[model samples]
Target: MSRRARWLAGACASTVAVGLLVTGGALATPPQEDSDRSARTEVAVGAYLHYGSPGVERMRELSRWLGGTELRAGHTYLPGDTWSNIEGAPDSLRSWARWRKAKADRLFVLNVPMLEHNEAGVPDGRVAELIGSGAEGEYDHHFRRLAERLVALGVPDTVIVLGWEMNGFNYTHRCRPDPENWQRYWRRIVAAMRSVEGQRFRFDFAPNRGGDAIAWTRCYPGDDVVDIIGMDSYDQPPGSTFREQVTQPYGLQHQVDFAKAHHKLISYPEWGLFRNGDNPDYMRRMLVWIAEHKPLYHSITDYCPHGVWQCTKNPRSARVFRELLSAK
Candidate 1:
């Protein structure tokens, strides 16, 4: 059976951490001009919102509350969902991008899932069939179309996080059980999207932190096709202190080392409090770590159970988040 299917049949422990630690002290400001590509850190803050109801207004409110611009929107798009309805026109992803752009020159970290959202029940043979043999044509067609649509919608520079967290055993796109096909699939998608005329999109290869299910590096599709190495880290697997989290094998330090070796920028497309909730020290340590290591961008998943906004769940952590993010 596929990993996702087995996961659906039974519950398993959560084992992912996606925090991007900033190097040095304080968040570095971006260079004045686009051409000034100096060796400096630029940390962009953002969040994943609950769809439809709160909308971008909540993000704006959070920005005001935090005293900074939430410049990136960490949005996810499953295969058959709104943003990636490959069968339909690009209205959904386009409208969402336009909404985000209307707020600011915002960067969209779009998590594009390879499999359909309801794939948890899918048999392993069917999953393999979908990803293998002649599937490149479908991937190329939809991905190029999506790229063209994003360019048309004024978001040509969108960061496409394809099949994120593939190392985890729970997702339909898990790299294990078939790493060769997974890597090939990633390369094909990248090639298809890049082939679009005037497309300047960046592809991010992100996986959950730690060697929980599989070593993420085993699925590395090469630095040539990947622009950023991202991790979806949170305070997971419980009881590990912040220091232990980063120092663990296939942890933050390993991710950083891998990115440095490949000459790529690091990113945390998703992160927040989890497993052990309401831990303000985790919040403080994470912010300090981000300020010290200096990642390209990171976003907190703000919603019930894992959210910091609304304050009902994690008030202390929320306060710490605001204070640290507001600092100059």
Candidate 2:
């Protein structure tokens, strides 16, 4: 009907293509190799399989169970019962080192308690006293020794979740008693750890989900000393829904916002079913949440009341876990 208009349109399209080719436009299609690499790197997942060398082997087993879901993170806890044990106890380090060295992209996450007898129900008054003392650098040498030990063990590039869940009442390091001293102690520990030679560690300031003893925001030690903002989320409160977990103040959405505001990456070092026992809805919702957010890494606490593979109490949730996380 209009040949002249069609001809003009074709000419303009040809000119644009020529200009793009001449300018090396970024809109040009990317290589298939780069896209494939992206698909492989999107999900970095793991779980708390065990606390020692057994955990190293358990990762492989868990992977097999998940139809070969690759586990890039190895999570563990340094015993809070004694100082020597907390100094990177060799019983587990050697194996974990071997596992980490086997793969260049693998990660090692360690939950480090700030003080001995971390869960021994030390009174708030005493906790305040110890936290104040730590702020004054009285316990600096202990962290320095631990840092040195991590370096010696050949796993210096670790993600240290130091004094995690500080906003909760379960740990003696809880920030309610004295938030200022707690923050100072956190900074001191980070300084001592960073002072170690050959160390490439990342510090995660992780707090329990929800406002437990106090608002976790009050305990932040500043961005200069913190690398990742992490949360240990669990399905809880018997009847609460995941919607509440997202919309509530100081909740999951708040965590993402907080991390964005601070210009830091977010992580879920620990998450799974808790008080709402054997709930598959919680499992499905959590998996969707993590996929949407795309955190640096996440490890579910795979033990009783919160676990799937290790604990047989949540079979429906276990199926959801395998289905979503499976590489197959």
Candidate 3:
């Protein structure tokens, strides 16, 4: 079968492919001008940080370290300690925005509270209810509020990957097989964000490529609705070669194939080095992959270090971390 044919078949919905071919190109931006006045696109490297404690201090250092190099952007959780409603969520977000504005040109969010608040593992009743209620507008409204705040805080259009890796089975709705619900929620959010920001914000539909061609095909939110085809994968130490660990399930080209097929950009938003086997050498190998393929728009490692005030403490990972920040 033809590629498009296969895509359509796997999606099990023709509207998805049709929506992809039309309507802003598969969760696409509203045709922003890629003029020279705008900054050229480049990959970023940063880490995920929760607000409070050492996050504030470590973020300061991370930004400082990356500022001296070619690092393009940073990714952080939303409501970054500046904006707060109840627990000061909005306040936190605004704070992070201010912090980011001073250093990085762009920032990406992996998940948002709107989705997290209602997240139930795959087949969650709430997910079913959202889909069942057919209230795409309600779901979209929540995301729009978040996006609006991001814009209000001065985050540019080219940063921000809303709901990254929502398709993976690990998070809420572990592989929620209903493409329509996912598509509806996704498109509604994208549409709401665009209505506010226009083409100023870039969006990403991230998923874990587990060699489940069906997984990619099954949950694809149509082609036109996505701006970037992203994957999150990693190779822990002590098991296989770094090359084998990182590349086996989904290699760089696999990502490229998905991007080419969908006409989206590429990125590996969340990845890291776990304690699998070879120790420091494995970390070096992972860095080699980043250097060699340059596959990510900007990369982030899992750097929380499992305790308060403990970031940048993983010595094995820190070596690669310093090297990546230093690489211009």
Candidate 4:
């Protein structure tokens, strides 16, 4: 799209007036879609880490468990996969990217590590290292290198999610407590990567379910900087019934609405059900609801290191997850 078309399309697509009212006494007429209006928020499917060698066997099982249907969609993950083999980091990421591009019909996401995190050897006190004294220069170079590699692999700019959950307190990379440094580092990363790949890769910024509100209010890096707005959400733990999980979609909607408000696309870059893996029948229902209601969620990443550590330990939960990923 040309610069002018991109501008017009974004403006029209976002301005979905709730109920346009006229003083001329006419009925509340809805705004019309102009020629430039875009219907771009369609759901895409995929696993999180589909490329697995012996070094990444567990992740491979997670992806294969998701099955062929899921793999054909795409996958996303940060560089540090539990610090197991940091030496294979670049090659691992590249291997996964190559698998998704070659095997999947739609390679939806390629997540890059953006912030300093405990997983990446950044100590908690290193928040100060973000933008002070040129410490971020090294991080900037890393991101630039990854962006270049992805573009070279035939992944579009939009398919890349630069950072995954910035505000959640759980992950080591979560930048919630350091908003200013996070914002500064983010701007530099975006600028540097764009210089290398241009618009071929659509930059995505994902925050935890409610993290978007905090990140957006603190900074406005311009709509051009972000192509898709993303949220990472999951269902209630295993003790609950399928109906309980059904209600969880509403929380996901909050993320979608927030994205719509900003004229950006929404995606569930990460999501899965816990403890429920044993009930394939009910789990299938949950997947259907996820696909039907969370239409804006372009990718569903059911695979993560945490899934092994936290979710799939129980045999029943593993069954539920298999049903979900294998849902046809």
Instruction: Point to the candidate with the largest lDDT.
Output: 2
Per-residue CA lDDT of model 1 for 44-104, tens digit only, reads 6677764332445566777777665444554544344332564225345655676657755
TM-score, every prediction:
0.81, 0.87, 0.68, 0.62
Local accuracy by lDDT, each model:
0.66, 0.79, 0.48, 0.48
Worst 10 residues of 1 by lDDT: 9-18
What is candidate 2's CA lDDT for residue 220?
Answer: 95
Ordering by lDDT = 2, 1, 3, 4
Q: lDDT tens digits, residues 14-125, model 3?
A: 1211121121112322222332112223345555444333444465566566444444445554431122321224455555566566754545444443254323343566
**Model 2, TM vs. native:** 0.87
Prediction 4 TM-score vs. true: 0.62
Residue 127, candidate 3: C-alpha displacement in angstroms? 2.9
| Model 4 regions lying over 4 Å from their true place | 1-42, 49-70, 81-89, 103-105, 120-125, 131-138, 156-158, 170-172, 197-199, 211-222, 236-250, 275-289, 293-328
- Badly placed stretches (over 4 Å) of model 2 are 1-40
What is every candidate's alpha-carbon RMSD to the true fold? Answer: 7.4, 15.1, 12.6, 11.6
For residue 166, what is the lDDT in candidate 4?
59
- Poorly placed runs, candidate 1 (over 4 Å): 1-41, 51-54, 68-92, 99-105, 134-138
Candidate 2 lDDT (Cα, 0 to 1): 0.79
